[model samples]
Target chain A: MSWQLGIEHLRDLARGAAILGTGGGGDPLIGRLLVEQAIREHGPVTVVDPDELADDAFVIPTAQMGAPTVIVEKIPRGSEPVGALRALEKHLGRHADATMPIECGGINSMIPLLVAARTGLPVVDADGMGRAFPELQMETFSVYGVPGSPMAIAGEHDETVVIDTGTDNKQMEWLARGITIRLGGVAHIAEYSMTGAEVKRTAVPRTLSLGLSIGRAVREARAVHADPVEAIRDALAPTLYSHLRVLFRGKVVDVERRTLEGFARGRARFTSYDGTSELELRFQNENLVAEVDGEVVCTVPDLICVLEGDTAEPITTEGLRYGQRVTVVGISTPALMRTPEALAVFGPSCFGLDVEFNPVEDRAETPAGVATSLAP
Target chain B: MSWQLGIEHLRDLARGAAILGTGGGGDPLIGRLLVEQAIREHGPVTVVDPDELADDAFVIPTAQMGAPTVIVEKIPRGSEPVGALRALEKHLGRHADATMPIECGGINSMIPLLVAARTGLPVVDADGMGRAFPELQMETFSVYGVPGSPMAIAGEHDETVVIDTGTDNKQMEWLARGITIRLGGVAHIAEYSMTGAEVKRTAVPRTLSLGLSIGRAVREARAVHADPVEAIRDALAPTLYSHLRVLFRGKVVDVERRTLEGFARGRARFTSYDGTSELELRFQNENLVAEVDGEVVCTVPDLICVLEGDTAEPITTEGLRYGQRVTVVGISTPALMRTPEALAVFGPSCFGLDVEFNPVEDRAETPAGVATSLAP
Candidate 1:
């Protein structure tokens, strides 16, 4: 059965998306507001599972491309996503049957729902990345042989660009990011076009529901005065993200960030309240590596999430600031992301890091009540 | 009636385009080779006057966007221009009846011919810019109220982007140049789409024929051992450009160039062979200002052409080198370009220059036997 996403579910979705964001995908506040506004105006958005999609269903994946800092300043015109999709449809000589998130984290997660609300097309429950990724070609769709273009991008200034980079998703991302910079640092893109069958085979299934559950768990825990951190662990325990643990609980002490080639690249350091060991996080739009006391603690595609110590609010990489007390959580990615084909794209080596990727579950000690597998 | 663009004519067109280039538009060598290959493979392209077009005929303008230095290094796949046009046409749901050059100068002139040769469409004898300018919004089409967007850009990597910037051409140029940089420093673009009636009403008519005539004059002058500088003046005097004069005859002494924001911006200084005076040329894609011996000579909206002293070969901005003997010629622009609306866009102030624009014919001393009138 299909489910409708209304205002009641927005908070949970935002929380869940942030958990999956893994410290990237940009902040979801504006995206959540945009989705709420769209849903209110156009009524509730319908979301369908991958199995429910017809064989010939035309699915389009979309997200905002640019630095998170820029996205916060450049609000979309609301019509750009629809305009871009229409332009792409005009180019393809057909209409899309559904929309889907390019990734499950941050703004990308909400953008597809907003697009669905506006276009009246049901959004698929699956996403390209089970978690947020910094680059376009890193998606499971590409690993499964889905071409990134012919893609469509629409700027806030009523400008739309349709890109065709063949199978080279890297080139497409380079070109798209370039346009995004010119569009005042942010632009909406619809790419990774596929049929329902392709989506079912390659996509990370039920990610939408997973994010919602994560968000709801935190919200319910907060209302009942339960531990939100433990709630997150319990929420993801039965899902693809079966392993979860807190890597550090400390105050941010240092951050070094610079916008390079339209990406926010930098590192953040945190120190324990007792002045013990320090944790350093490196990222390019998303946290790529986490080192505690100069030892590698976790690496991508394993999740590295930063949540507020008290409010349990997830903090995006772009939102990292000095002196904020936060808890860093690590979670195991879906089994699909561990395959050789997927690892080559999302592993630490792909990001130019030298360390061999150790699954977060294997690196972290299993808690008293939790059973786990350490096999790679 | 339509006419064929032969190899002989191609040489004249390139030469003429270089003259009109006003030290920008980029080097024409690669563009010439691309067009030659296209013509050789697809047979000669057809050239048609604006008056010959059907009112409803779809006319698309095309050009290569990027720095000349970049174009020299990154060659095209030869199919990108046609591919971009096809993409635009597919988006528009109609085939273009004709092709037009966005400018009459440098590589832009040859790109249309190449596109025409490949698409089997007639090349319009009109252009948006009588001479090249640094930005896309400076076109006569924009001044005359034609929008710049609903345009398509294609990369050599098989990527195409369609833009719609509404009444904002500056944004369009910014976005387009950004895409160009990401496409390995250069990309083919098809923009400023219009109908045949709109083309006739707003386009600088007969720019192709005008460029051809200027080129032929220089070629014939070189062959017959006549004064090439005088030949240029005589050639332009009969067309919409009535007043022409030699601004300086000198050897380049120094050049300062920097690639910034995807444009080759710099200044070139030349001292007369007899060491009597010096001429300074400042450019951004095209020469915008010229000064002789610390006095203003000619500025943008007027042509500041640099030619080989003996051969009358025009030199582009990027090709400027120390010690090259050259003759600088200034030609009055079309009457259409001098309008208040047009001047507001292409004037000196638009380029951040402090000087008020004075028509070249008004500023320059009228030679004996030459009748000139200058009024804005």
Candidate 2:
């Protein structure tokens, strides 16, 4: 089903997308404001179902690429994403029938909305990554046979670079990452241009609506004095991310973070309230692994999200700070994302983690593996 | 005002270009071999004068951009320059009427020949830099108001990146440099696409012919047992570059070179045979400053070329080594390149040198300033 996403829907969408961002995907509040401003100026955008599009319809996925920490300070010039889209359209000599999110997480989920709002093009309700990954090759679109090249990246001053050839998606990411650093550590990109059929086959479907539902559930639960953490679990119960669990309830004790090679890379350690247990989360932009006392509890392609202890609000990697009371959650990724092919692209080993791919459900089933209590 | 460049002309062109390279521009022998291979397969390329072009003729300048040190080891695939040219043509949606050299030095001079030999496009007998400068922005084309982008860069594996927008030439260079490093240390580029009128007004005219004359002079002088260094001076007597002098004749004692940020950078120290003085040549790809006994004798936007003491063969920075018998030559740049606007772009300070850009003639006028003798 298609829906009209007006200014009113932005807050919930941002909240839900932040949760899905895991820890990366840039700052949600900044993205929300940018989207709100764009929509306010250009009017509401239509969120279309991927299935409703013709096979010949051209769809372009657009997002931001850089260290989330840099994006926090280097606010996008708002026109960068639209400029990138237009540049790509000009390069391909085709008008995009719809714009979609490359990744349905944090600011990336909102970038397409901003582009759609500004260009008056409907946004397809799907994304390459249902949850964020650090590099471009990690996308399901690439894993499922979409070329990342013929991609356009735009900087704040309207500088546009179109990468027309890459041996593979990894090379494309390498080239784009280098350019992004030169473009002031952040750039808006329009890439993975696909036909409607490819979008229907490769994209994670209905992610925008899913983000909105997750956001609304948390908001409603809060108003009704219900446990927002349980509300989040209920929201994912009927979705592809059906296995959700609270990995830990603790205060952030240490964060060793540094912006490196176009990514925010670091490890954050949390101490449980009883002070006897510890959880360590290592991230490269987004949370990639969660370890309880050095025992792996969850690793990507499973979501390892850090949320506020009481409010259940998503906390991005850049937003993590010492002494903050937090709740860590682990949710299983979609079946398509956990496939052997997909895992090869974004599995724990891809992030240089020593562990193998193990689903969150399997890890959570072990009684001693997780601290599910929500108490701070 | 046009001539055919067959396999016979390549030797002279490469020799002259290496002199003009001012100790940078990659390895001439490697470039010559690549061009020779291409020409043998595709036949000769026509060299057209700037004046011969129709006002609306589409011209693109093609060259290799990276450290000379890297280009020597990496070696081009011979197809990269043409790939870059074709990609840029596609981006612009216009067929190029001709190709030209972005610089009249080293491997860059041969790159356009290779592209033309392959594409059957005539090469304009002109270039952006009469002599080479390390960065893209340090070009007469840019100094005289040509845009550096809508530029295309192609790697060995056929990966192409088109930079369609850069606020200015420096930003274009900065962006291209970052991409070049990611492209495995060397990349071929087609940039500064312009109209024939822009070419006529901005380019350093007939640099290819000038390079040929310099090479022929050195070769003939050597064949006849004449002073090859003096022959080099005579070759530039009537050209736009009228001032020439031997800055030093000595054996290289210490050479410190490292490839950094896509440019070969270091200093070579030369000791006079009498052991009374020392000459230090500091360079970033291309020689930027020549200091004799810690006193500046030459600096950009003039040329500081290093040549074999006996053979007068131009030696690139990457080829510099301790114990090599060498002679440093300083030549005045053309009047157009000495303009305030041009100096601001490539002057001494631009390379972080402390001295002002004094013409080589002024510096050589002081008898104690340079050693003009041919003795080792």
Candidate 3:
């Protein structure tokens, strides 16, 4: 169904998003409140189908990249994306005809509305990538040959700088991140310029609707007190599912970070409520892999999500810390991310994992390394 | 300075490049032979000034970025930069009019000639970065707003991928480096598409000649039996000779490398000829500083060049190793690199110095870590 931002719809959208966010998207309640409040204050967002787009329409997609943990405490100034959009418009010498999500999970899902509301641009019901990625260039647009540079990327206080990685994503990342670090850790980026022609060719068609639908299913489950996770799994129809491994649900035991080329990279360890088991999540941007008992289980391209222990609610990486109860969950990559190019973008190796590619099935067969479960 | 080259010019260019390669450009011997043979078999390269560029003059820049050690063992299978050029030109719908260096240091300076001569494009008198940076986007062009996307990068066997990193050098770096690792740790890239206007704004002017002159100075010093270290010093005209520290010639005792985000970041310890003292070189890509007896002398933005031991020749970071004799030299950043913008680009903090900027003068009086050296 199209967006109607009624309390019921917002409820459903949040629930469904929890399931579909697969482990990486932040808890949807906050975003739901935000989107709902924004809608309540501004009116419900109207989602336009890509097929409805005019041929000459300009479409822009935007998102936040960096450690998810950083996003929680720092909170976006909310002006960065808007500023980036305005800058892009200035550069293009025209207003964007439309805009869409670059990623449909976590804060990114809500960001489209915030930006759309500000730009007066229709929010397209689509996304560039079907799932989360560690870097800006991993989007499907790059796979389809879209440019990611000369992009209007803004930081806190509306500090905006356009980057032209000139086909070098590493350089582009360094340039944007260097500026962002100069501004602070988090940044709002508006990247991936496309003609309607190219957008049609590359975008994950109707992903915004998928986001909405995923949101809806989770709502229905919670309303009926059903399993929201199952509701999401059924909705996405993911090609495969590995046996789930619940890593831990106690408190964050440790967190350490190192700045390399100015990006936050490090690891976090959490202990179980039982105080007997421990879970470790290693990440650069999105959580890449999870290890229990010192054994690798979930890997990149696959999803490593965290939830509030009792409620089974989603937990953005940044929200994780000591005394925070979190249950870790893993989701296999949808068949879309399994594409060679997609894997090339998010594979285990992409995260510097030394292990060779082991598809979801093989991943499950491997024993979970939960600390208490170890042979000790 | 203009166009047209005879056999003599190719020999001069190659020989001059090797002399200046600072011992890290890979053995110029084979590459020089290949290029020399290419020029001899075909014709000499015509060097054209950027001003002479035709509006449609197809120009591409090429370079090697990785553990330089890998480049020697894995000689190109006769593709790479040429393959990148083919992929780029194929996408551009035009033949290249010229090819140029990514940077005029080490082997990278000569790598572009492989593509230039192979594609029949004149060698350009411009380079992307005035000096070598460890990562792809650390170019003079990147600082000036040139991007690294919409690129043609590939492996030796010509596994070409035409990519647009969308203006984030970080993305380009991630993608190119991902490809490089996928291709076994070496990828040749041809990037930076300018409308001549962009190039004029961003590309460092006269860096190639600067390199040639620096290389020439070293050659002249050796011929006259002058200290090559003094020759490079004479060539660069350091702001403070008082801070000059010709650290001891020595052999590496240990090396530590961490392949985080595809960069080899670590430090090296060396024992001088006296064997009682020690020198350590800290590196990200190029050497950023030199410490003798635990004192910091050179720092980033300033240059910490390592020339060969005895011979006092320049040695690239990757060229350094255990049991290899090397003389450490330091040079200050050009005034251009001293600007806040330039310092921001290559400052001590940029390379993880974690200190305030300090000029070479005070750096000598106290040394890099002495609190004597702070990033400005």
Give the 10-residue window scoring lowest on summed lDDT in candidate 3 chain B.
B367-376
TM-score to native of every candidate shown = 0.94, 0.98, 0.57
Leading candidate by DockQ: 2
Every candidate's DockQ is 0.65, 0.81, 0.04
* TM match of model 1 to true structure: 0.94
What is the fnat value (0 to 1) for candidate 1? 0.88
Write one digit per residue (lDDT tens) for candidate 3, span A1-376.
Answer: 3344344455555544544454445445555555665666566666787777777788888776555555555666566687788766665566787778887666677777777665566787777666566567677787667877657666564444555455665555545665455455567777786778777777767766666676676656778887665565676664333334444445678877554543546788976655665678886646777777677767777667776554456665555566665656666655656788877866778678886655544654322224333212
In CAPRI terms, model 3 is classed as: incorrect
Question: Can you tell me which runs of candidate 3 are displaced by over 4 Å?
Answer: A1-12, A33-43, A48-71, A77-109, A115-376, B1-15, B18-42, B48-62, B73-102, B118-121, B124-284, B287-315, B321-376
lDDT of 1 by residue, A1-376 (tens): 6998898998898989988988778788888899999988999999999999988899988787788767777788677777777767877878899999989998889999889999899999999899899888889999999998888888776677777788888887787777777777778888898999999999999999999999999999999988888899899889989988788877899999988878889999988766766889999888999988887878999999988987678998878998998888888999999999999888999999998988987784423112221111
Error of 2 at A375 (Å): 3.9
- Residue-wise lDDT of candidate 2 within A1-376, one digit each (tens)? 7889998998999999999999989877888898899888998989999999889899998999999999999998689999999999999999999999999999999999999998999999999999988999999999999898889999888899999665388989999999999998999999999999999899999999999999999999999989888898999999988989878888999999999999999999998888888898999999989898878889998999999988999999999989999888899899999999998888888989999888888764423225556563
TM-score of chain B of each: 0.95, 0.97, 0.83
Candidate maximizing lDDT: 2
* Order of quality (lDDT): 2, 1, 3
What is the model-wide C-alpha lDDT for candidate 3? 0.63
TM-score of chain B of 2: 0.97
Q: How displaced is residue A186 in candidate 1, in Å?
A: 2.0
* Cα lDDT tens digits for candidate 3, B1-376: 5766554444345434543343334544456656666776677676777776676555678776665556666676445678777766666666766778877666676677666666677777766655566667666677767776667766554445554546777566655665565566667777876655555566655555555556667777878887776676676563222234454566778877554544556678887555666877777655666678877666765656666755555555565667776666655544555668766766777776766677766555432222221112
Each model's total of backbone clashes: 7, 0, 66
